[model samples]
Target: MEGKRVMAITGVHHAQITIPRGAEEQGRQYYCHLLGLPEIEKPESLKGRGGFWLQVGDRQVHVGTEDGVERSSTKAHLAYHVTDIMAWRQRLQEHGFQILDGVPIPGYERFETRDPFGNRLEFIQPLA
Candidate 1:
């Protein structure tokens, strides 16, 4: 027992989406406008690093800028629970965001959309 490892489960505290430096603008347009998240300024010290913070209710998502990293939808993703799926889809399309129609996630209805840097984002809402 002295070397035993313990796993703790508490709910998700926060999540960060990493994008290439200078791709923050695309994140702002797609996430802030389409998803209705408020953009909070990244600290001045972090400004030069190229990222922005978005406030999503009690959770915070930090979009960070990673230099020279190819955007890959296969690696990481963020799933958001949205109230209005159709409205969000329409708005995102109008803004020229590439959205992929996907099958429902079993217990939940969901779809996928890509950010400017190709980060895969999923929009989901429980089926009534």
Candidate 2:
């Protein structure tokens, strides 16, 4: 059994983040309008549940609703691979979003920002 094959998993299918109840519109605006992620329809069975889905290239980001005060974590976050890190930084700043510099990682340029609900998000571009 030294070389027995195990279950193979491909890339990520989706990443889910939660927002406070009644904040779905805010989530939609930030993800769809500002981030430019196209909104995807949720399945009929899940439509009764609040929140929506957005397309992220081949993957998806599922924004769900939670019943409680929203609190953001400083450490846990979603990092996305991008083509132009600086351009994204500028775009976010232009939209009145605060950009935070990420700790230096060799061969990678990245920065951090928050969504409307204060969820941490990171964008990274490989250094040439």
Q: Pick the candidate with the highest TM-score.
A: 2
Model 2 lDDT per residue over 1-128, tens place: 59987888877899998888788898888889888889999999998899999899899999998866444655778898998788899999999999999998999999999887888999999999
* Predictions: Cα RMSD each: 3.3, 2.6
**Best-fitting candidate, measured by lDDT?**
2
lDDT, model 1:
0.80
| Model 1 misplaced stretches (Cα beyond 4 Å) | 1-7, 41-48, 73-75
Per-model TM-score, in order, reads 0.79, 0.88
- Candidate lDDT values, in order: 0.80, 0.88
**Residue runs of model 2 more than 4 Å from their true location after superposition:** 1-6
Per-residue alpha-carbon lDDT of candidate 1 for residues 51-104, written as tens digits (9 for 90 to 100): 889988888899887877666628577888888788878878888877887775
